[model samples]
Each structure stands twice: as structure tokens, then as C-alpha cells.
Target chain A: MKRHQNLLMALAVVVLVALPLWMVHKPAPGPDGKEAEIFAGADSQAEGLIGRIDPGYRPWVKPLMEPPSGEIETLLFALQAALGAGFIGYWYGSASTRARLQREQETTTSC
Target chain B: MHIMEGFLPAKHCIAWGIASAPFVAYGLRTVTKRVREYPEQRMLIGVAAAFTFVLSALKMPSVTGSCSHPTGTGLGAILFGPAAMAPIGAVVLLFQAILLAHGGLTTLGANIFSMAIVGPFAAAAIYRLVRAARLPFGVAVFLAATLGDLLTYVTTSVQLALAFPDPVGGFWASFTKFATVFAVTQVPLAISEGFLTVIVCNALARLNPRELQEMRVATGSEQEVQA
Candidate 1:
């Protein structure tokens, strides 16, 4: 069970790191007052040993060169939505905490 | 409110992971002691199994159509006490993951911590407080139900914020979005849950006060320990 959790965590790390890096170089400066994000082409080649075997290789996974909405604010919030999810996790741990607190209260009350 | 995939920042997930470790440990310890102290371990396990089946199987659609199931902790908390419910909820979540695939096994701790540990406490607290205020049983039940659902979302939002914190938007905005997702759908669902919980509580109250007392002893306030 623990190993499965580790594997999931590892997969999450790999995807999170590689995907964003594979897609965008940086947020571009917009003509207006905003900053724009530029897209990376799937055709761009990797230089490492793995790529040496197949120099002309393309990535199996490809995301749109463009951001989902092209809005940094929305994209940022979407990220937040994922990260903030543990609030529910904390709630899941609460019932036992309740019983513990109540037990403490009972002791104090009796005293 | 399973927190959705790719919703939160990595940091939030890690922090929640840290926060959950102790709860899991403590819940296991307490549950072990309870089973050892009591003679009806099998019966208790059966009750938990049956109760949990209802909790996950009785799903109704929420805003996202992601299929929200009842935490069902209100009655469980009132019946058992919050401590005992942690393992039950965790087990139920485990079962749901295997049987229903409603939530992820990777996120099992997070799910158990929220739905089981948190839901019952919020419900039980509200129940105790409302009853102490001399409110009607129905009102007490409704308030507990509402708070349980609200707290569940709040916990979920916090988890999201921790998993995916952004320096620009900060935690508040993140909290707002997550909370809103729940608020839109859960507000109505909770109202109905409150009505149902009230009905159930009232029915059980009438049907068998002794069972309620036993459950309360199993799950509830610290006073039971001293008694």
C-alpha cells in the first residue's frame, strides 16, 4: 500500500515537472499591459543520451502550444484549485480530533 | 468534492500529507484499543461495513456530476462518537476505492481524513451544541448536517490551497474558488442532508435509544471514557 502511494507520488512528480517544461519556455510580454505565454513546439528535439538513439524523435505526449485560456490569472487559479484540495483532507481527519477534544472536555468537566 | 485531479499546487498536497499522518496513527491506535476492550468486535465491524456501504453507494449528483456521496457521519458520530468513526470512515473509503473507484487509493488518507474524521466531528459538535441550546431535535439535526457539509468543503479547500499555493493569488483566492465549487452544489445537498439526517435521527431516537447510547459510547465525547 505504501509503495503504491510512493509510486503515485513519483508519477505525479514526473508529470508535473516534465509536462510544463516540455511546453513553455517562459511567459511572453504582451503588446498590451499583460504578459503573454509562448508555446513550445512538439517538434523540438531533446539532446540527451536517450535522444541520441533517435535524434529526430518527437514526444508521445503533446499539449496545445497555447495556454488553456491564455489568461495567467485563470491558469494560476486553476493551479490553486489543485493545491488547496487538502482542506477537505483536513476535514477527513477531524472526527477523531473531535472525540479527543471531547474526552479532554469530559475530564476537565469532571474535575 | 474529491478535490479533482490537477486542481491544487504540489505544496498543498505535501502539507496535507504531513497533516494526515498523525491522524491515521492516532485513529488506528484508538480503534485497536476499542476493539480489544469490547467483546463485539465482529458485530461492530459488521455495523461499520454496512453503514459505510450506504455512505458511498448512496451517491447523488452534485454540480460537476462527479458523483458526491453522503459522508453519513452525522448519525455515525451521534451513534458512535468521532474517534471510532475515523477507522470506519477510512475503511469505507478504502472499500469505495476498491469497489466503486470513486476516489483514488493514493488519496485515501486525504479522503478518510476529510469525510470520516472531519465530517463526524462537525456534525457531532453541532448536534451537541444545538441540543444543549434546547433546540428541537429536527433543528439540531439540520444544523449538524449543514455544518458537516460546510466543514467538509472547507477542509477540501484548505487541502487544495496547500497542494497548489500561488504567491500571486495567495491562499485566500484559492480558498475562495474551492469553497465556491462546494458552495454552489453542496449548499443545497446539505439542506437535504439535514432534512434526511433529522428524519433518521428522530426515527432512531424513537426506535432504540439503547443502540444510540451504545453507538455514542463507541464514537463520542470524552465523558464516555470516564463514565
Candidate 2:
């Protein structure tokens, strides 16, 4: 039952992520009878809004290095996720193994 | 919530940097103290950092027809206290700033202040309040994580509004516009983050109850949710 709950929670996260995409794919018609734009980054959207709010505003600084291309940026993002996920997986394995071993030890000693 | 690279004027950037420095320093100290006191927690600390790393990289879609990633600092805040997330978030933001050019170095301070400092502190406070009300563990964690995520975006909106207030409507108008772009879009992603945090905590409760207990996440009587 406990494991089932965990699985369900995991599934919920997936569904939540997917739900927005599904909504966007077939969005309800707006007042103008137009479909909403596809999912763009909120950060960029905010930048656009800022431009509208203050057209004269200019960014004074630039990134130290650029990703060179969209594909490269995606690659870097994927790498970040991969690195983090890898460590998480390691921690889970270590923790689960330690817990299982300890449980076995306790059973033997209690017996 | 990245205000983007160099989006904030130089003055705002410097002010944010000054504002964020003390928190980051305190966070570093807190982390060092925690490590010295409990060497066993090193792995878990890494896990918290890693969790931020992964979640920030994911730009999930939102119901507002936009995408934004969850800060993912709430889990670390709840686990390691709010202060610890400052450095952890700084590192993740630094990674994005340097490599991906997603959030720029100039804006790192403001981004960190919003996502790392404010979000974590807010999450921790919410967690405390919800737990005090005797809410279930899952409910507390969900509220903390979700609200924390939303508040980070709200902070970003505030930063942007302060930087570029509307010519006609001023700060409030700019704030509403930015909030519509960032915070409204964040709702679904924030909920997703809440569920993800809860799943991670539940797994930790089952697999490493002792660590959870040491972190005060699984207290006596309350820890029984692992069942």
C-alpha cells in the first residue's frame, strides 16, 4: 500500500507536467476566437512585457558565454538534469541498501 | 524565476547583490555547521542540491499557455532549513548563468534572492505553520512546496516591476503585468513541484527514516506516515 502511494504520487507529477501541454494543444477559443500561443518560457514572456512597458529600456550586461545555439542550450539543460538525477539515484540506492541491510541485521539479532 | 541576464538595471543588480550577500553567507555557514555536526547528512545535502539542479532544468508547461520551471528549493529548505538553500540555489543558478546562458551572471543575485532566499524561507515558514495546525505530512509538504514555487515567481515579478515600471501605470501596473506572465503561468508547475517534493519525502521517510528524523522532518508520532 505504501509503495502504491509512492507510485501514485510519481504518476501525479507526470500528469501535472503533461496536463498543461494537453490543454495548450487544444485550447478553448478565446474572445477573439484565437488559439493561445504554444508554451513559451514565462521568463521570455516577462521580457516581452518589460519591452512593452518600457521600450527605451536596454539590458546593460550580457552573458559571459552564450550556448551558441538552441540545440546546445537544450543539451546543457539535459546535462544538468542528468547530473542531478544521477546523484539522486545514487542516494536512493545507498539509502535503500543501507536500510535493507539494517533490517536484515535487526531480524537476525532479534531471532 | 530568472529575471534573465542583465535584464535588471545596474543599480537594481547591485542592490540585489548586496541584499543577497548576507543571506548567502549565512547559508554557507549554516551548511558548514550542519555538515560538521552531522557528517552522515552529506549525502542528503547533495541530494537536495541535485534535486534543485534537476528541477530548475525542466521548463514544464503551465495552464496559462506558458512554461516555467519550479525552483525546487522547497525540499532542501524543508530538509536542511531555509537558510541552506541560498548556497544550493546560487550554485544551480550559477551553472545556468555560465553554461546555458539562461540566467545571466549580472542577474544572478536577484534570481538567487527570489528563488533561493525568499522561496526557501517562505516554504519553511509555511511548513511550520501547516504542521502546527496538525495537517497531514503530505498536505504540509504540498502546500509548502507549491506555495514556495509560486512565491518565487511572484518575487521575480516584483523585481521586474521595480526595475521597469510601466510608464503610465507605475509599479503596480508593471507588477500585475509581470505577475500575469510569471506567477499565473507557474500555478501548474508549482503544483507539480509540490507533488514531486512529497514523493521524494515519502520515499525518504520509508528508506531513511533516521535521516528524516535527524532533519526533524519525521518527528515522533508524525513519522508514522511511512506506513
Candidate 3:
């Protein structure tokens, strides 16, 4: 059963990964003969739409800090994610150890 | 989805903020009550929030020329009911806005409505529905996470449509365009998130059955965890 489950998971991962690549690479240009962008996020789309609607509109607020470059911004985000994941992993490990120790103590007392 | 700063007009921003206030308030009350009742839950909630932050921060390639990330709301909603995710999600969004420049203060409410409220509630509902139907544990987790991710984008489309109706075709046309554009990337993202969430849940169940049990009790889902 475990093996079957693992196989299913592997299939899902491959399909999920491949679907995006195919969508990105295989599509012919539209009527305008312009290739579709492969990665525009929702926020940018919304911003672009708003700009088209009202060219005069300005963002009322600005970010306090901007990264030196796009790559730096991505690097910072990755760093934060790694730190957060590490913290959660550590907490879960320690919490499990504590629970095991408590269970052992209770068993000994019962004896 | 993190709606960019100033993408929303002031009134729309305020309106969304107003709409989200009650949910955040109620979430805060539930979280405090849970923490007071079970001190251990404090750490659990923190860890869950951290997990959300990390998962959301990991960007994946998408079809729209912009990267997309998983909301991570489904796992939290499954562990701690939908309502409780509001405040946790708010914190994560706020941090992203300030620290990462990913989201913005003005658009925080709109972003929260999509990622926090709508996504989490949908996930929690689907999870309960699937589990109640006697589905397998993996199926329930996959559906909840996938649907949660998809619905977040759907809600974002609605928000964008409301704010920017099409000049000729009106709101419906605008919504269709936004949804279609986003679906290019979102569909695959949803599937990937589902598989990733299932793996994470399985790992948690194996390494910390006690924690999983606590989550079941806290979420009021007393069903036995399948091996």
C-alpha cells in the first residue's frame, strides 16, 4: 500500500511539473502574434489592469525598503522561508521528544 | 495572492478592511481562548504560523511569467478550524508586506480576504465534507489543499473585477479575463500544493502523533488518524 501511495505521489509531482512547462512552451502566439508571459502573478495583473483603466492613478503608499535588485528580493524571501521552516521543524521535534518522555514517565509510575 | 500596494483604490481598501474586521476579531478571541485553555497550543499555533509563512514564501514557476506561491492556509485550517486562521494569516501577510515587499499595507485587506478568509474556510469545509464522506485521509488532504489554493485565486479575480470593470463588457467580462489569465498558472500550482500538503501532513502524523491528536481535538474533529 505504501509503495502504491508513493507511486501515485511521484506521478502527481511529474504531471504537475510538466503541465506548466507544456503550457508555457507549446502554446502558439495569439491573434496579435504575441507570446503569453509564463509567470505574471495576480498582483501584477491587477496593477496592470488598474493602470490601463486609469493612467493617472498613483499608488498612495510605497514600500519602506526595496531590495537592490529582483534577485536580491528573491534571495531575501528564500532566506525568510528557510528560517521559518527551520524553526517549525525544531519545535515539532522537541515537542515530540517531550511527549515521549512524559509517556515514559507515566508508564514507569504505573509500574 | 498578494494584491500590490495602491492597486486598490482607497475606498476599496477601506471597504475590504472593514469587511475583514469581524473575522479577525473573532479569530483573535478563539486563539486567545485556546491558548489559555491549553498552554501547549501556544507553541503549536506559533509553529503553524511559521509553517504558513515559509510555505507562502516559497515561489514556484508559473505560466504567467510571474511566480506563484502556495498560501499554506489549508493545513492551518485543517488543524485549527477556518476562523482561527484569520489572525494568523493576517500576521503573515503583514510581515510579507513590510519585510518582503511582496504585499502592501493599502491592499492588505483585499489580500487577506482572498488568502486568509476565503481560502481557509473553503479548505476547512472541503476537508470536513470529504472526511465525513468516508474518503481516504490522503484524498481529503489533497482536495482540501488543492481547492483552497484554487479558490484563493478565484476570490482574487472577483476582487479585481469589482475594482476594475471592463469598459465594454462590464464586471463579468473583466472577471472572466482575470480568471482565465490566472488559471494558466494557478491550476498547476493548486495541484502541486495539494501533493506538497499531503506529504507534510503525512510527515507530521508519523513524527508527532500526539501533536496531530491535539490538533484533531482542537479542531473538534475526533476521527482516528488512519495509518
Candidate 4:
């Protein structure tokens, strides 16, 4: 039961990620007369509402350093994920090794 | 819940910065104290920060037909207390602001307030409440994380609404519009975060029982540590 629960949890996460992409209805065309982009980031969508609400408002400050292009932005985001994944990998590896060695030590002492 | 770099006016940005400063300061002190007192748990702390880093970078599709990412702060808030997540979250938001330009420097305070401070506090509170109610361990973590994610977006909606109230209907109407945009898109992603946090916590309980104990996360039945 415990094992199945774990599997079910994993399955739920997978379903959450895939469900929208799999079952979404296409939104109406955007202002540019092209079909609205699917799965666009909500942040930009909020920015759009800001524009509609107050057309005169303009962003006063710009990013000190932005990725030069979309690809670079993706690359940086990928880099962030990579850095994080690396730490998590190190954590699991060390923790597992520590647990295994401790278990072995306990058995040896008991014997 | 990134409000973009310059989307918030100068006054609003400063206001949020002021509002968030105290929390971040206290949190930074907590992080330092943790490191100083329990050197063994440094790696676990790193893992917590990394979890947020990875989770926030991934823009998952939501049932609302938009994409949004989870703050991944709930687990840390649950494990280390809400205060510690503030500094960790600040670091991650700063990274995104400067490098990815996903969130901007101007709006960093508001973003940090919403994603880091408010979300973590809410998560930790809910975690305590649910645990006090004697819910299952998994249920507590799941609720803490899912609600934390949702509340972060709700805070963002509130911030945006405050800054740009509708000419016709004022703050409430603007809040409704912004909440519809952000919070709705966050629902599925929040659920995914809840499950992911539970999976991670279960693994930690199994493999690093001592660490969890030291962190005080393995209480009672939650202490299903490898025997």
C-alpha cells in the first residue's frame, strides 16, 4: 500500500503537468491576428492586463542585464535548473552513502 | 508571480522593498544562525534552496491554459521554518532578476514579498495547523505546499491590484481581474508542487533520518525513518 501510494503521487504530478497541454481548447486569435499562444507564462498575461487598464503607464526601469535573446534566456533558466539539480544530486548521493555505511556499521557491531 | 522588472511604479517598488526588508533581514540572521549552530545540516539547506531554484525555473502548463511555476518555498518553510526561506528566496529572486531577466530588479521586493515572505509564512502556519489537527503527514505537507503556492499568486494579485486599480470598479474589480489571471493559472502547478514536496520529504525521511530529526521534521509518525 505504501509503495502504491508513492507511485500514485508520482502519477498525479505527471498528470498535472500533462493535463493542460493534452486537453486545452485553443484560445481566440491575439491582437496580431494569429492564434493565441498556448501555455504562455501568466506573468506576461498580467502585464497585458496592466496595459489594458492603464495604457499611459510605461515601465520606468529596465533590467540592468537581460539575456540578449530568447535562446539566451532559456539557456540561463536551464543553467539555474542545472545548478539546483547538481546540488540535489550531491545531497542524495552523500545522504545515501552515509545511510548505507551507518547500516553496515550497525550490523558489524551487532555481529 | 514575478511582476516583471519595471512593471511596478517607483513608489510601489520602494513600498514593497520596505515591507519585505524586515522579513529578509530576520531570515538572513536565521540562516546564519543555522549554519553556525548545525554545520551538519548545511547540505540539506543547500538542497532546499536548490529545490526552489529548479522549481521556479520550470514554467509548467496549468489547466487555465497558461504557464506558471511553483515557488518551491513551502518545503523549506515546513522543514526550516518560514523565516529561513526569506533569505533563500531573496537569493533566487535576485538571480532571476539579474541573469534570466524573468523578474526585474525594480520589482524584486514585491516579488520576494509575495513569493518568499508571505508564501512561506502561510505555508508554515498551515503546516502547523494541519499537523495540530492530526492530519496525516503527507496531507499536512501537501496542503502546506499547495496553499502556499496559491497564496503567493494571490499576494501578487493583491500587489498588482493595489498599484493599478480599475477606473470603473476600483481595487476589488482590479483584484478580481489580476487574481483571475495569476491565481487560476497557478492551481494545477500548486498541486504538482505539493506532490513533489511530499515525495522529496518522504525520501529525506528514509535516507537522512538523522538530518530530519535534527531539523525537527521527523516528529511522531512522520518519523518513519529507516529502522
Q: Pick the candidate with the highest DockQ.
A: 4
How good is chain A of candidate 3, measured by TM-score? 0.66
Instruction: Give me the candidate number with maximum lDDT.
Output: 4
Clashing pairs in 3: A38-B63, A38-B64, A38-B65, A39-B64, A39-B65, A39-B66, A40-B64, A40-B65, A40-B66
Candidate 4, B69-148: lDDT as tens digits:
99999999998999999999999999999888788988999999999999999999999999999888789999999999
Top TM-score model: 4
Q: What lDDT would candidate 3 get against the real structure?
A: 0.79
Of the two candidates 1 and 4, the one with more favorable lDDT, higher being better, is 4
Q: Of the pair 2 and 3, which is ahead by TM-score? A: 2
Per-residue lDDT of model 1, residues B1-227, tens digit only = 45422222344445555766676677678777766765444343444434444444443444332234455566556555566677767766664454433344555566666777787788888888887887766677678876786677677666655554444677776556556555544554555555555554543443333444555522222343345
Best-first order by DockQ: 4, 2, 3, 1
Clashing pairs in 2: none
Worst 10 residues of 4 chain B by lDDT: B218-227
TM per model?
0.56, 0.94, 0.84, 0.96
- Candidate 4 has an interface RMSD (Å) of 1.0
True contacts kept of each: 0.00, 0.96, 0.56, 0.87
lDDT against the true structure, per candidate, is: 0.52, 0.89, 0.79, 0.91
- Give the DockQ (2 decimals) of all models: 0.02, 0.80, 0.48, 0.84
Q: How close to the true structure is residue B31 of candidate 3, measured as C-alpha lDDT?
A: 90
Native-to-model Cα distance after best TM-score fit, residue A53 in candidate 2, in Å:
0.5
Of the two candidates 1 and 2, the one with more favorable TM-score, higher being better, is 2
Off by over 4 Å in 2: A25-37, B219-227
lDDT tens readout by residue for model 1, A4-56: 53355445434533443454444557678586433221111101211433345
